[model samples]
Target: MHASATRLPSAAAWTVGDITVRRIDEIALPPQTGPWLLPGATPEVVSQLPWLKPDFADETNVLRLASHSFALTVDGMRVLIDTGIGNAKTRANPAWHDLDTDYLTRLAAIGFTPESVDLVLLTHLHTDHVGWNTRAEGGSWVPTFPNARYLTTRTEWDFWSTTELDEPRTQMFRDSIHPIRDAGLLDVVDVSAEGTTVAPGLTLLPTPGHTPGQVAVRIDSRGATALVTGDCVHHPVQLADDALGSCVDIDPEQATATRRALLASLAGTDTLVLGSHFPAPTAGHVVTDGDAYRFLPYGM
Candidate 1:
């Protein structure tokens, strides 16, 4: 862990009736992350959307992106959505490799310790998202959340497990993912087009395209609803234009479709939109911006 890591995030949050969703602090991804992840969101494109400046992007038009997770408690069940890039692991991406952030310390500070987590909802099995699934222990990787059931879509599990992985992905699985499965902690759920309810107020909405089985987490409690945009929507720039997609997307066309539909559902609704990769002021409401949409963050 870094010695100077902040004790807490800015503490961004939204309430879904009874559950208080907290944005657990993780490393603020470097500026280079924006270009590589969302190649279509050029400086020209982001400049046109004045709303994105300062918070979502820098003056130079570099989009701001972060790696964080949402945590909450309901009915005595603790739920953590998406684990960020972990520490001391071999990663192909230089920004992610050997990241030694105090992510777990921040999580534990919020009362969601490795042992306290009941459900670890993985949006997808990407390297950054699943890094925390395991930790270097006795020269071998082990499940970080030993007590929690690591839940993911059956489609996602099957695709990765069966497909021939490249060296990087193979290394990722060997270190961060396989340990969970070996520990009998990995559980897959079949999500239909309509979506699947995972817990009392939590539902996994199928938003494929970024990956074969990527699902966005929807939390509804006491009539209030909030949606967590997993990989389906990487950054707020995608909100300005549906065409702006991540270069790593498995299917660009389908990813665009999923993003469009998901944004439409959220447009002008009370449902709080929590972006998995969004920078501070991460949770917000979606608003239409003439032929497109803009993220009206919570504070403003």
Candidate 2:
């Protein structure tokens, strides 16, 4: 375990009709390689920004968890929103491959089984987002949810599958994506052309920004709604300064507009908000904090 993970609280869960959403855990990559996804401004830029601060977590807390993934269960379907960095995979960053957290086991506590997953919804194809897309099997990568169909945005697939993808992100296309495609289980979603109804009460909202074809998932039942804001707005800081962009974002300006639009949609309703990368127990609602906004955690 990393030194920072020790301070994390246990995982938490929430339900929307037949859909049960769980905030898996928190994740942090070193600041040097890239800026954290939300408000992905460079450290120097972050330092200069008026809203930026040195620390976002409690100093006494040892775990510095930041990113997150969610598991979604609806009707008879068990689905995972995004897979966090998986264990025992070799990466350019030595620290990344060495991570060995017990996220799957944690899922078991809430009645989820790896085999039980019916679909895996990937907002986009990023290394961290698809780590658990497959697992090691017979010395080769195999689908993590063998019975599930791995969904990716169509535009994202068209981009990454082409030579246009840069080196750093290209391997992610190979390592996490190719295997599923080879296995005949990858589903490319047309977020622009059609709105897919994967199961009852679940909908895919095309909220692109952080990536070319990024998307958000919405769960509604009996007028109660929840928007699973995949990477629409990574951190609360983005709400404060629309110009600040996460380091890895392909287009910062578009990302800002997407964030603002999402915030506006979730502003005054009881609609629950969930993020793929927020603090642990990642399900929460955004409320105005000062001139900006703050993430209000749902009861753990």
Candidate 3:
């Protein structure tokens, strides 16, 4: 289907201290050049980074990217970090095959439904980050948050549940991750453990090589902080070309050394980075732009 155009400002909540974070857009892809999705992203290296024009490229430079998700309320909890590219799955990339949009009606118009989500943070298991975690009902494939709790990372569920994928990532692990492990709610955790907590301000860092065991969702609260970069900085010109990766970064030199140590631990720090395929003001802050690094997005 995919017809709703002109809905630019999709959603973008952001609180931080009390912890809110919202960003629900499911598609905002226009300018796409750079050898077609970041192979050094040329246009003369993004026109020598003119602070990435307009809102991340397009004055002919072309780059824009977005496929969103990140609800994240705090104490009472309602997580949901990455679950885009979902709807009618059968993808071999024909721009994410067999699709439709209105991602859960834009996640219940931002109030978040799907049984009020309790937690579904899968920062890995790519294929557009586990396409909605399941939802094709009558024809089968279920668990679209039926009382959440989906988290991942037992080394990213033992490498996509015993690696061997091909036909569109083994039909995206048999329909969005084995129907959330057949509805037992799938919770693998142990993100290289040390009090991994996924609530009370949420946490889990291990920014692995874009896929390996990829995790990133920090959030903190009253003291304020935020991370959520699940694809490890997809576009923001890879925060000033840290060897520009993402041609499906399987290990582009350990995803460019995990994006230069998470942009040197949030360059100047006020944290708040939220970019899993960043597009419209997709939240940002990592600075220090001399040797390289600069994604100041939040509201500018």
Candidate 4:
């Protein structure tokens, strides 16, 4: 069991039929992170989208982003999606290197204790998404959720395992990914053209391009549907124009195509679009706006 040293307040959860998905708030990304991550979302572009102001962006129209995990229970199984930048981990990115947050406490608030989690889903093996896979333990890194199966796509693991990683990425793997694998907790699943259903009403939809194996998690129940967009759609601004690409996108053109297609599929539908990085009121419905689409905040 992961020890809860302290407690912190967490955000609200939205219901998708019987399941209640809560956002375990980590640190809100600094203002600079927005511009750096999605440089194309300039003041002029973001401001033009009137719906993005006051909540999704600042007065200057700088995007608002966050690092968080989505926790929910399905069939008595506790599932956590995309662990955030963990506590006290070394990283080349100053924003992510060796920090502290109340992420664990937030998860526990939603009944997601480390030992109790059955599945830790990784949309891709990105540093931020996988940082919490391991925790500092007696001068060494160990699996944070020792009992849970840390899962990702087979393609993702294959790509990273064979690719030559730079020092920074290698350091992340050494501390985060490697420890989980070494402890025999990592599980790689094959995401097919039709998508893979991990559990009842929970399917992993292939949304490649952010990375070759990125996935968007879909939840369906009681005739309702919700999609947890991993990095496929980083923010609401992207909905306004698919051309606004993230700087970190592995394959820019493919990423844009995936985002565009996903948005098109969700527009004018009832599917609840849950953005993995959207700052607040992250759950919403995608609706068509002019030539592109726009995100209509949930219950709004």
Candidates in order have lDDT scores of 0.88, 0.67, 0.79, 0.87
Best by lDDT: 1
TM-score of each: 0.96, 0.82, 0.34, 0.96
Q: Mind giving the per-residue lDDT tens digits that candidate 2 earns over 83-178?
A: 877776777665466577777787676666788888888887777788888777788888878888888878878867674766655766666778
Model 4: colliding residue pairs: none
Candidate 3 lDDT over residue span 1-300, tens digit each: 111112225466777776667778777754543356687787888888888887888887777787888886777878888898788889877777778888888788877889999888888888887898898989989988889888888988887667777887887888998878887998898865343776787888887776888888887877778888888778888878777887887888988897898788788878778788888777768788888888877654
Residue 162 lDDT in candidate 2: 70
Question: In terms of TM-score, which candidate is stronger, 1 or 3?
Answer: 1
Alpha carbon RMSD to native, model 2: 5.6
Superposed by TM-score, candidate 4 places the C-alpha of residue 147 at a distance from the truth, in angstroms, of 0.9
lDDT tens per residue, model 4, 79-166: 9999989999878788898888878877777677889998989999998898889899999999889889888999899999999999
Report per-prediction Cα RMSD to one decimal: 4.5, 5.6, 17.8, 4.6
Residue 25 displacement in candidate 1 (angstroms)? 1.4
Residue pairs that clash (backbone atoms under 3 angstroms), model 3: none
Ranking by lDDT: 1, 4, 3, 2
Error of 3 at 70 (Å): 6.6
